[model samples]
Target: MDGTRDPLARDERAELHWLRAENTLLRVQLDILTDIATGYAHDVDTILRLRADR
Candidate 1:
């Protein structure tokens, strides 16, 4: 019996694996962006408070 059984089935499985890996990478990047945005927001708030005090 052939290992592939069906060539399309093998290809589909490979594609799905690649997509899952890509999705994981995107999620990690999005989390990093969110963190950066939150940091910037905090910095802006601090600056605003200092300006208001003057």
Candidate 2:
């Protein structure tokens, strides 16, 4: 687009790209955190069940 030379337009595009990258990174981190939380919950439940059996 001819507007690429426009400073304001370029700045807006750069900011949008940065925001998208940050959003993607956050989503990945959230997925990892959720997996870790789920694993911990499962482990805790198992531990409780074992203790109850005793």
Index of the highest-TM-score prediction: 2
Q: Could you give candidate 2's per-residue lDDT for residues 1-54 as a string of tens digits?
A: 765664568889899999999999999999999999999999999999999999
Query: Model 2: which residue pairs collide?
Result: none
TM-score of each: 0.82, 0.84
- lDDT, each prediction: 0.94, 0.94
lDDT of 1 by residue, 1-54 (tens): 756665468889899999999999999999999999999999999999999999
The number of residue pairs in model 1 that clash at the backbone is: 0
lDDT of 1 at 47: 100
